[model samples]
Every structure is written in structure tokens, then in C-alpha cells.
Target: MKPFNTGHEELVHDVAYDFYGRRIATCSSDTTVKVFDRNDSTGEWDLSDSWKAHDASIIKVCWANPEFGKVLATCSHDSTIKVWEENIREKQNSGKRWKRVATITDHKGPIYDLAFSPSHCGLKLASISTDGQFKIHEALDPNAIGSWTNIFETNTLSSAPSRQLQSSFCLSWGKSRFSKEYVVACALEQSYIYQRQENGKYTQTGQLPAHGSIIRDISWAPSIGRGYQLIATACKDGFVRIFKIEEPVTEGGNLQVSLINQFDDHKGDVWRVSWNLTGTILSSAGDDGRVRLWKSTYNKEFQCVGIVSAEQKHDAIED
Candidate 1:
């Protein structure tokens, strides 16, 4: 695989691709977010815009679905999350095409991760932070999408270690409009699922069980055609655990969850787990400096299918 340079003065924390993969957003500990657009003629990625989006290290950057226009959200150690928009992308103007549309600073601790809800879920943003806090903001006005309201907020800290030395908070939105709108977030060693209630409030419906170590990250796979939901979680125990969750068959039914698979191939703290667009394959990044891919076999058993390392001078390795 070919790599493009992201020129940052400090270590880059996250890189996100736009909905159509036409643009890339890279955020760094240097507190700047750079957007690179793919040049159709040259077949190269060119930096189209760069700006200081935060006063502290940017922990994560996520692109909103293109249906919401060219929007990007970044969370930082500044204890804030900013929503940016590039409304003038179709124009050739060289000046920064991106603008900060909204700034959310309701967190008492550094924000670690944020995700935009699926396009059908309306314009919503969910975030988790170091102080065991979680929040979901919605842009209710179709005319003025820049304005946001804090519709849901909660603190997950329950007598756990007050301070964390690493990035431990993360959240992901379930990609289905058929069921209730829900988000899964991690705090301390527990992962909780918050579902939107009939009262227009989100409440914790369930918690994933058997995770004893600190969960570093979590992802909810898109269950496009699947009958059930799959969630992958990476933890400090060096295991990437996959859980199969059954949707509520009846109104107000409880979620049925079972441990489907767990991989210890990382042999160290697994930092992140992400699913492909189709939700057929899963990828986990770890302290091993390698990314491992997992796929389900015909027997419904998950298997490690590939590995990619970022080490210098090392050729690619696969199984």
C-alpha cells in the first residue's frame, strides 16, 4: 500500500476519510487538522486546507455523512469538540474552504473520541471524554445547521480511577434506523449502550459483560443485511473481543448479548478496532505496531485473514 505524507510537527493521532473517500482529514497532537483532497487528474492527494482547530492535541477526527454536506468533527484535549464544514468545496477558491461551524465545550475533561450519527439518524454528534463523561448534541434546525443543542449528557465514572494516563474513552453509533437510535461508549473497564427512549432521552440500556481490563476502544459494525449486531472491543488485556447482540424483537425488549469471539493475536494492548464498510471484516490496531484483519468463515467463526505493519523497511506480511 502506498502512503501519503501528512506533514505535522507532532505525532498524528487520527486520519479519517470523507463519506465518498474524496477527501482525507488528518489531525495531530500539534493541534491542527489538515484536509487533503484527491486530485482527479494527477491521481495524488493534495493538501487543500489546514487550520488550527483546537488549542490542545486533537485526539480524533470523524467525517459526517456526505448527506450532511462536507462536515468534519474533531475532539481535542482542550476539552472541546468542534464541527467544521466545507460548503464551498465545489468552488476552486484557494482560501481555506473549511470553517468552524460550531464549538462544543461542555466537557469537564479532555474529549477523547467523537462520532456522527448515521445519516438517517438526523444530524447528531456523540462524544466521550476522560472524566467519564458522555454527551450527544443535535443540530435540530435544517436551515441553521451550525447551531447545536446538548440533548443528552451523562457521567460514567463510578468510583473508578479518577485519572487515566492514556486515551481510554471512545464511542460509536449503531448504524441502523429501524431500531431506536443508540450509541455505545466506553469508560474505565466497562462499555455501556445508551438507547434513545420514547421520552426523547437517551438511557443506558445495557453493558457488555466479561471485559475486566480497561477498554481502549470500541466499534459497532454496520449490520446492513445481517439479522444481528456485532461489536468489537479492544482492551488493555491484549484481546480484541467481538460480541453478538440480538435486536429487540418486541417493543421495549432487552438486548441479548453474547461473546462471539476474542482474539489475542495482538499480544499487547489492542488500541483500536474498526469494521469495513460492509461490516464483513474487522481490523484491530495494537501496540505491536501492526494492524490485523479478521473475517468470519463459512462456519461463522472469526479468523485472522491479514496483517499490516507500519515499521520502516519491513515488507508487508500476510497470512
Candidate 2:
């Protein structure tokens, strides 16, 4: 792996690659956001731009589709989310830069995650905060140059009163064009799935008891004409859990869900889980500082197929 130096004085919280995977954006605890562009010929990454993007520590960054131009969104501990757009100059020598287009201020606490919807969904995004709020925003115009209005918000405070101290952490939008718009959010001790209604409002469709502790991350697999939906969640309980949502035959029917698999091999707090583009392989990382990959066999049983550890060997260094 080629290391690219990000001159932030604090820890980098998150990094996101553009839809084309040619550029990357990173947010840091130093309240700055930096963008890097890959050199197509040299295969090296060069710092393209850096700026102070937030008033507090920036937690997450997400890129919009290339069809929408070079746009990005960032959330921070300041309890605010901002959308930025890049102005590309035609002249090769002219400099390109990003400017703040819109700022959303509704969440009462730190925003942990932000995700842009699939290109087919138009210009929409979702964010979850530590105040137990899940919110959705939609761009007024297709080009995303207009204002973004908050279309929906759900409060999960009443769902787990016993774990009030541990608020919502992560969320992911379902990437299935075959189904209606859906988003899954993981809070303190539970996960909730919301679906858009015919009236253009979002309502909670289902709830999954995801973990005993804080649910750190949630990822909805991309469904390519799949009959069902799959969601992967990582939790402080040291386990990664997968849930399946079955499609309903009739309109307005409740979604059916089942726990398909759970793995505790992380041995510590699991932080993130992601699925392959085809939704066939799964990967996870945890406090153990190791990345593990899981795959399914013919019997539909999920097992750990590979691992990359962070441990160092003193004997090998001495030799």
C-alpha cells in the first residue's frame, strides 16, 4: 500500500473515495478536510486540496456520484452537516477548488455517519447522530445546485430507554433499485429500517435487535435483482451480525426479517462491516486491529476465509 501523507494534527476519522474511485477525501479531528487525486500514469496519490470544513472535529465524508459533478458531504462533532461542490476550471493551469454549497443544522449531537443515495435516487442523503436522530435530505434541483431540504427525521429515543447514554451511531441506505427507498440505522442497542411511503414520507418499517451494546456500523448490501435484502452490522459486543429482509408479495405488507448469521471471531469491539459489490463476500474490522473476510459455501454457511493481522514480530525484525 502506498502511504499518502495527510498533514492533519489529529486523527483522521474517515476517508471516502469518489464514485469513480479516482479521488479520495478524508476528514480529521483537527476540523479539516483534505482531498487527494490519484495520478493516472504514476499510480501515486497527490494532495489536491485542503480546507477547514467544520467548526469541530469532522467525523465522516461521503462523495456524490460523478453525474452530479464533484460534490461531497461532511458531518462533524459540531452537530452540523455541510455539502461542498468543486469548481473545475477549463484551463489546465487554472486551479480547481471546492466551495460550501449548503449547511444542515438539526442534529443535537455529534453526527457519526453520512451516506449519499444511489444515482437512481436522485440527489438524496441520510445521516445519523449521537442524539438518536436519523434524518434524510433531498436536493430541490436535480443538479444539486439548489437548496437541500430536510424531508424526514426519526427519533429513536423511546426505543431503548435503558441505553439512553449510548445513542445512534451509523446508518446505510439500501442500494436496490428493484425496491422502494429504504434505509437502515443502528442505535444504542437496536437497529431500525425505514421505508418511504406513497405520500412521500418515510416511516419505520421494521426494527432489528442488533446487539447488547452500541452498534458501531451498519451496511446494506447492493441488491441486483435479489429476492431478498441483507444488512451487516458491527457492534461493541464483539460480533458481526447479518439480517435478511424478505420481500413482500402484496403492497403495504410488512417486511419479514431473520438473523442469518453472527460471528464473534473479532474478540473485541467490531467497528465496521462491508459487503462486496455483488453482495457475495463480507469483510470486517475491529479493535483487535485485524481485518477479516468471510464467504459463504454451497451449504449457505458463512465462514472466515482470510485475515490480515496488525501484529508485529520482534524476532523477525531482529533477524
Candidate 3:
């Protein structure tokens, strides 16, 4: 992988990818989200299109409906999440370039992360903010332009009556094969599982340590069936911890969770951990500026996968 460093001399807050992994979106201190296209022929990503997304640093970008093609949602330090579409009409008709279509501004603080519900849910999306609130939006509205509806909100104070958990530095949704409502993971001192009930209320279903330091990221394991599925929590403690939810048949089917695995290979803070679509391979990146890969096995340890530093690797190879 090549670094498409812009030489902007600013820190990049986050990066996001479309479901297919062919397109990537990165929000930067430069206040813009740059979209890149991965050229399989050369194994290189080319800058395809860009949008001046925010007045301040752009914090995060999420694919709103990747299944529909060229649709995205981005959040920024400007306290807003905007839905954008790409019009590749010129590129499709003339076989040349892709472009961004629209930007819908809706939110109150820096949006840290977002997720579109599984493909089955269509254009629905959920976004979280540093203001300690999470919002769900339709992403697309035919009747009105740049319109959004807030379906859920979390209190900012840990002491609030509605606050089952405190501030969230991260968020993730569980995609279990059996369960219907999506399980939302809130990252903080005491993490919580917010399960959307049929009555339209989110109830705390479970809680975990969430993180040793701050939970920077969380990933849900691909579900198999009615059995227990796992979730990977990436900590600021330089490790990724995996946990499995077990429902005991004896205790009236109560759920029991246990830490199943941990990857303490990173020498620095582990910022994020993502599982491939198949849940077979795992990739992690962190403050060390290194990306490591892990696999599913009884080994119970994550090994060095790939490092992004070319000069460091070249020196090690030469030595």
C-alpha cells in the first residue's frame, strides 16, 4: 500500500471505506474529504474526487448506501453530519471522471463515526457525535432536499437519568444472524449495548469494560446463526480484545460474556480494528502508524501483519 500523503502538514482524524473496499474516504484537518479509487491493475489508489466538506476539521465519513453506488455521509468538527452523493454521469457517459453530488448538513458536534444498517435496511444510517449523542437518519429524502430526522439521542452527562453509559468516543452495530434489531456498542469507561426494542425504545441489553484506556473503536463479528457471536473492542491500551456473548440455557437463557481473545501486538495505541467481510482476517491501525493483520485460530495471539512504513521496513530488510 502507498501513502497518498497530501503534505498538508496537518493531522488526519479518520478514514472510511465503502463496503466493497474499492473506494476510500478520508477526513482531514484540511477540512475536506478526499475520495480515492483503487485501481486493481496497478494496486494503487488514485484521487478521484474531493469535496470541501467542513469549515473545520472533517472528523469522519461513512458510506450511507454503498449498495446504491456513489452515496456517502460525512461528519466534521463543525458539528454536522452531511449526506453527499456522487454524480458520475460525466464519467459514465464520457468514460472520464466521478464527482460529488450533494451535501446534507445535520448534526450538532463533531461526528466521530457512522454506520449504515446492513444492506437489508437500505438507505438507513446511524451517526455518533462528540457531543454525546447518536442520530439515525434516512440518508435520502425524495420529498425534501437535505432533510433529516433524529430517531435517537443519548444524554451527554453520565449522571443523567437517561444515560445508561457516558460519553462515546466510538460506536459500532452488531450484525448477528439471529437477532433482528441491531445491537449498538457505546465506547467509554463502562460500555453499553443499546438494543432497539420493537416499541421504538433503545434498552441497555449488556455492558462490558469497553476499554482499559479509551475505546477508540469497536468491531462486530460476522454472525453464523442462533449461537453466540463475538465482538472485537479496540482499546487505546495498544490491544484489541475480543469477547463472545454466551446465553446460558440453565439460567432462563440469560446472556454471559467472556473475553475470548486479545491482540497486544501494537507498540502504541490501537486506534481501530476491522474484520474483513468474511470475518476471517483482521486489520488494525494505530498511533504507531502501523497496520497489523490477525487471523482466526486457536493460537490466541495476533502477529505482525503489514507495516505502512516503507523506509523502516526497507532498513530492516537490508539489516
Candidate 4:
């Protein structure tokens, strides 16, 4: 990937690709969202569009649906999550572009992360905030306007004393191939997964000590006829551990989870770990500003396939 700078005076916190992967979206501390397009023939990236998006640093962004290439979502330290949709062709010709479609303000503190469920209905959204709360929302009417409804809220304050001290930070969702429901994983003091029940409520399915320090990111593996697949979580302690949930049928009919593997390579905090579309390869980025691509094979260890640096240059400014 080529580095396409926007000439902004701040650092970019998050970036993503549109549905077609032809266009890229990035949010920065400068409170602007920029879009770039990849030139097919030349294999070079070019800046196409940009806009002032938030009042503070945009922390994260995710595509609602890449197929339509219509909508995108972003979260910020401004304590809001905003959705933006592209305008029609005619409007774009007249200098009109993407506009804010929705702004969710239920968060009391800065929103750190967000995820759109892969179920395709855009009915469910999961968000986590610095206030140590993870919220789950559902659409009141699937096809109606302003259909979102808050259904579940988990807070460190209301949880047990042991959990109350654990701070909630990262959030992720996994679609169950066995069912239409999606599972939400929140990384915090302890890592846990909540599965959607048939009755429409989310229930805790598994819990584990994610890391020595705060868990930065957690991803669940896709099911391939196995009970429930594994989850990989990154930690500030510089370790990545993989855990698998075991639902072996006991005489009493019970389910259990087991720890599979843990790998320690980085000396600093591991900030993020993402699985590819196929779920076979994993990518991790951290405080060291180095991205490492890992593959699952031979041993339980991760083999770095690629690395990207975010190093800064120290030099005198030109007038």
C-alpha cells in the first residue's frame, strides 16, 4: 500500500476501505475525514475527497456495507458516533458530497470503538466508551427511518466489585454461521463474549483472563462445523493469546471453554489485531507503530507476513 498523505497537521487514528475497496477513508486528530481512490491502471492511490467530520479526534471508523458503497460510520473523542452517506450522482456534480445521516449521542464519554453487525440488516450496532460502558442497540423497525433502539448496557460500575475495577475499551462482533445471530466481544478488565439468544437478548457465553494488562483487541474465528471457534485477544502487556470455546456434550449436557495458545513477541503494548476476510491470517499493530501480519500454521506461533511503520520524522519546520 502506498502512503498517501493529506497534508493535515495531526496524526490519523483510524482508516478503512469502502465496499468496493477502490476508495479509502481515513479519520485524523485534525477532525477531518478524507477519502482516496486507487487508480486501476497505475496502481497508485490519489486523494479524491475530504471533509471536516468531527469536533475532536476521530478514533475509529467502519463501513456499514461495502457493497452499496453508500454509507460509513465513525466514532470520536467528541462523545458521538456519526454515520455518513454519499449523495447521488447529480448532487455530487453540483459539488455536494457525503452528508451526516445519523448521529448517536448515547455515550457519556468519548467513544473509542464501534462495529456494525455483519448480518446485513444494519439492525444491530455495538459501541464502547471511555466511561467503561459497552452498549448494544437494535433497530426498532428494520426498514423504517430512525429505527435504532437501545437494548443492552453493561457497565463496570454495575458489575461485580472485581469487574468494577476493570476498564472497558475495545469492542468487536462475530456472526455465527450456525445461526443468524451475532456475538459481541468486549475487551476490558476481563474479556467476555455475549451471544444473542433466540428471545433477542444477549447472554454471556464465555469469560477469560485476556492479558496481564488491558486487552486491546479481540477477534473470534469463523466456525467450520466446530462447536464455537477460537478468539484471539491482544494485550498491553505485549502478548497475544488465543482461546477456544468447547461445548463438548457432558452427561449433564454442559458447555465449556479452553485456552489454546499464547504468543509473546513485542516488548511494547499490542494495540490492535485483525483477521483477514478468510480468518486464516491475523494482523496486529501496536504502540510501537509497527504492523505485523501473522499466519496460523505449523506451530501455535504467528509468522509475520508484512509490517508497516508509523514512525515520525524529526526535523525543523520550513517557513
> Highest lDDT, which number?
1
lDDT of 4 by residue, 194-242 (tens): 6666677766765665457878787776655545666778887888777
Candidate 2 Cα misplacement greater than 4 A, ranges: 90-96, 159-168, 310-319
| Alpha carbon deviation, residue 65, candidate 1 (Å) | 1.0
Question: Candidate 2 or 4, higher TM-score?
Answer: 2
Task: Candidate 4: give the clashing pairs.
Answer: 19-66
Model 1 alpha-carbon drift over 4 Å, by segment: 40-42, 87-95, 164-167, 312-317
TM-score, every prediction: 0.93, 0.91, 0.80, 0.82
C-alpha lDDT of candidate 2 relative to the true structure:
0.84
Looking at candidate 3, the ten consecutive residues that score lowest on lDDT are 92-101
Cα-based lDDT at residue 51, candidate 2: 84
> Sorted by TM-score, highest first, which candidate order results?
1, 2, 4, 3
Candidate order by decreasing lDDT: 1, 2, 4, 3
Compare candidates 1 and 4 on lDDT and give the better one: 1
What C-alpha lDDT, on a 0 to 100 scale, does residue 77 get in candidate 2?
Answer: 93
Q: What is the lDDT of candidate 3?
A: 0.65
Please write out the lDDT profile of model 2 over residues 1-319, one tens digit for every residue.
4556877899999988887778889999999888888998988887788888899999999998889888999999999999998877532222337788999998887888899988888789899887678899999696755588889998865643344354547889988888898888877777888999889988888888647888888899987756888888898889999888986789887788899999999899998898988888899999877778888788877888888664654211110
TM-score, candidate 3, is 0.80
lDDT of 2 at 258: 90
